[model samples]
Target: MSVSGDKIRHRYDRLAPWFDSLEGFLEGLIFRRLRKRLWAQVQGEHVLEVGVGTGKNFAFYPDRARMTAIDFSPKMLEQAKRKRERKQLDVHLDLMDVQSLAYADNSFDTVIASFVFCSVPQPRKGLKEIYRVLKPGGQLLLLEHVLSSNKMMAKLMNLLNPLMVRLVGANINRQTVKNVQACPFKSILVDPTSSDMIKLIRAVK
Candidate 1:
């Protein structure tokens, strides 16, 4: 891994134990609805879920979908494994980086990424990799926070990005929707959520 990737990995390693606690309150208040919106639109059998932090989305997945969930942080993956075991979910968990996927081209029927692109050191590279792995006409479902279209909120996100990254390994100002649109996908659809800071995206490959 590159220096930046190593840094992000180390940061998540430290945060792994308490990461769920941090997200727990918000999950019910805000995130669950967005997750529902994203997962409800998903269609496919073979699925790959990137950034499967603590396996929080495990319950939302349809029982019929075969899942492979990956995360760059081993510690985070460990926590996710516990969740998988507890829930008895049929998910294959791997420690993998999004920028360089291990699978062959056109491997997955569907891809999912929730709050993932923000922390990737090379968001475009990661996006491209997701594009590469999807079978033709397959879908990529995403629930993510992005740089707000509102100028003042955008400025606020830009201002907090550095601090947020240092604190939690996430960038607050990534224009992920734009990055998704720029990839080799056949089409892209986006729906605003959480005051336009979060989005539900469906990109066909």
Candidate 2:
């Protein structure tokens, strides 16, 4: 892992135990519905979930699809494992970094990421890895928070980004949609699901 990756791991390790509590109110009010809707749109037999924090999306994954989920932080992976057992979800979990995935090329039919790129030190590297592991004609499904398109909101996010990263290991000002567009995917569908800040992206590999 890179130095930044190490820092992220440490921060999230410390945050892991209470991460769900931190997002509970927001998840109950909004993100839970968005996650379900996003997960429902995925269509594939084999799925790989990158940054599968706390396995919150585990409940929404289709039973027909085989699933593998990974995160770089060990503590987060531990929490995710607990979630998997508690929910009785048949998911394989890994302590893996997105920028250096262990899977073979063209290994999976689908890849899912939720609110992940913002914290990755090298977001494009991670995206490229996701693209490489996906089978031809496979899909990359994402539910992400990105830099707002509105100027004032964008400025505010930019200002708060550093503190957000330092405190919670997440950046609030990433232009993840643009990063996805710049990747080598064959096709892209990008939609702002919430005020041009949160987005749902589907990219064909």
- Which candidate should be chosen as best, given lDDT against the real structure? 2
- The count of backbone overlaps in candidate 2 is 0
Per-residue lDDT over 1-205 for candidate 2, one digit per residue giving the tens place of the 0 to 100 score: 1238888889999999999999999999989988987898888899999999888888888899999999999999999998888898899999999999999999999899899998899999999999999999999999998888889988888888888888878888888888998899999998544558888999998
Per-candidate Cα lDDT values, in order, are 0.87, 0.89
Clashes of each: 0, 0
The regions of model 2 sitting more than 4 angstroms off are 1-3, 192-194
Which residue pairs collide, candidate 2?
none
Q: How many angstroms is residue 74 displaced in model 2 relative to the true structure, after the best TM-score fit?
A: 0.4
Return the lDDT, model 1, position 117: 85
Cα lDDT, model 1, residue 202? 89
User: Could you say which candidate leads in TM-score?
Assistant: 2
